[model samples]
Target: MKLSPTYRMPLKRRREGKTNYKKRLALLKSGKPRLVVRKSLRYIRAQIVEFDPKGDKTIVGVLSKELKKYGWNYSFKNLPAAYLTGLLVGKKALERGIKEAVLDIGLHRATKGAKVFVVAKGAIDAGLKVPLGEGILPSEERIRGEHIANYLEKFKNIKEDFEKIKQKILGEMNG
Candidate 1:
C-alpha cells in the first residue's frame, strides 16, 4: 500500500516542528543564553531569554519601536534597519552584562547571506559573541552611522522604495 505524499514525510518534517524543535533543543542544551529575533512589517524585536521549562523568565528585550526616540523611525526596510535593531538589542544586552549568547533562529532556516545574519552581524559588532562566525565589532553610534551609509550606498536601487516609505512617515509625523 502506498501512502499519501504528506504522510510519506515524518510528522516533524510534515510540519515546521522539526527545525523549530531542533533550534530550541540546541539552545536548551548549549546552556549559554538565547538571542531570539522576531520581525514584522513595521518593526523588529530581539530578546535574551533563559529557558527554564518550568518558570517565567526573560533575560532582556529590545524593541525597534522604542528605538524610534533615538531617530530610528521605521521608514526603511533594509539591511541597515535590521542592523540598527540588532545593535540596539546587543547594546542593551551588554549593559545588562550579557556578553555572549547562542542564536536561536526558531522556525527559520539558517541562510548564509540573509537579513537575520545581518542582524547577527550587527549584534556581533556591538560586542556580543555567537560562536558561529567572525563577530562584528561596532561602536555605540555604529547602528545609526551604518544605517545612513547603507542607505547612501544603495540609493540608486532603493531610492524609489524608500521614498514612498519616507513620505508616508513624514505625513504621519506632520498630521
Candidate 2:
C-alpha cells in the first residue's frame, strides 16, 4: 500500500493555481505597499494595497473606466489609457499619504515595455515613488501615442484627444 501525497488545504489558491504564493511572499516580505496592476482584455485596474494579517487592505483603486470622466474617448486597453489609469491611481495614493509602493504584477509575465511598466511610468510621473528600471518602460512617444503617427491617418485627431486627457489628469493631480 502507498500513501497519498500530503495536501495543504489552507493554500487552496496555490494548489488550484489561482495565486502564486512564492511571488506573493516576496512582495509581502518587502514590507512596502503593493501597487497591484491587473488588466482585462477590455480594461486595466490598479490598486494600492497594504498587507494585513486579517486581509489585505486596499488604500486606493483606479480603473480605466474612470477616464471617461476625464474626456478620454478611446480604447481602455490601449497604452495611453493604461498610463492615464496609473496616473489616476498614483495621484490618489499620494493624496492618501502613500509616498511609495512596490509594483506587484501578480501572475503576469515580465515583458519589457509591457502595459505593467507603462502603468508604473504613469505612477512615477504622478510623483509616486515606485521603484522601476528606466529600461523597462515603453518609450515616451509610445506612451503618448506618437509612435502610431506613421500609419494612422486618424492619428492627428486621436493624438489631440490623447494630449488633452493627459493634461486633464495632470491638472487634476495638481488641483
Candidate 3:
C-alpha cells in the first residue's frame, strides 16, 4: 500500500517539548538562569528568564526591535547585525544583574557556522558566557563584504558613506 506524502513529513508542532524539557531539567539541576534566544527573518530577541514553577514571573527580557530607536539598522541581515542584537541583549541582561546563564536555544539546533551562532558570539562578547570563546567576528571583512555585495544591490547610492561607516562599525565590533 502507498502512503500519503504528508504522512512522512514532519508536522509543524511544538518540537520545544524536548528542548524545553531539557532546559527545565538543566535549570532545576544547576539552579542557573536561562538565556533564551528567538530569531526571525527581520529581528532576533533574547531574554534571561528565571523559571519558577510556583510563580508567574519572567526575570528579564530584551527585545532587539526596541534597539532600532537607538539607531540600530536591523535591515542588514548579516553577521554584524546579528552580533549587535546579541550584544545589546547581553548588555541589558548584565545591567539587570545576570552575570551568567545557560544558553537555552529552544527548538533550534545549534549549528556551528550559522547566524544564530553569530548572535551567540555577540552575546558572549558582551560578557555572557556560553562555553564559547570571545564572539566578535572581524567586522571589517564580514560587514564590508555584506554591504557591498548584499545591501548595495538593492538600495543604490545610500548617503551613509559605506566605507567609513563600515570601518566605524568594525571598530565598534572589535572594541
Task: List per-candidate RMSD values in Å.
Answer: 8.9, 2.1, 7.5
- Cα distance off (Å), candidate 1, residue 116: 1.3
Model 3, stretches more than 4 Å misplaced? 1-20, 74-77, 133-140, 143-175
Best by TM-score: 2
- Model 2 scores a C-alpha lDDT of 0.88
lDDT tens readout by residue for model 3, 31-144: 677677777777677777776779425676656566455454535455556666667667767777788877667777766545666666666767777655434234444533
Best by lDDT: 2
lDDT of each: 0.63, 0.88, 0.60
Backbone clashes in model 3, listed as residue pairs:
none
Q: lDDT by residue for model 1 over 12-108, one digit each (tens)?
A: 6537554555556767888888888776787667788887869526788876666455554444345656665666677777878889988776666
Rank list by lDDT? 2, 1, 3
Q: How many backbone clashes does candidate 1 have?
A: 4
TM-score of every model? Answer: 0.64, 0.91, 0.64
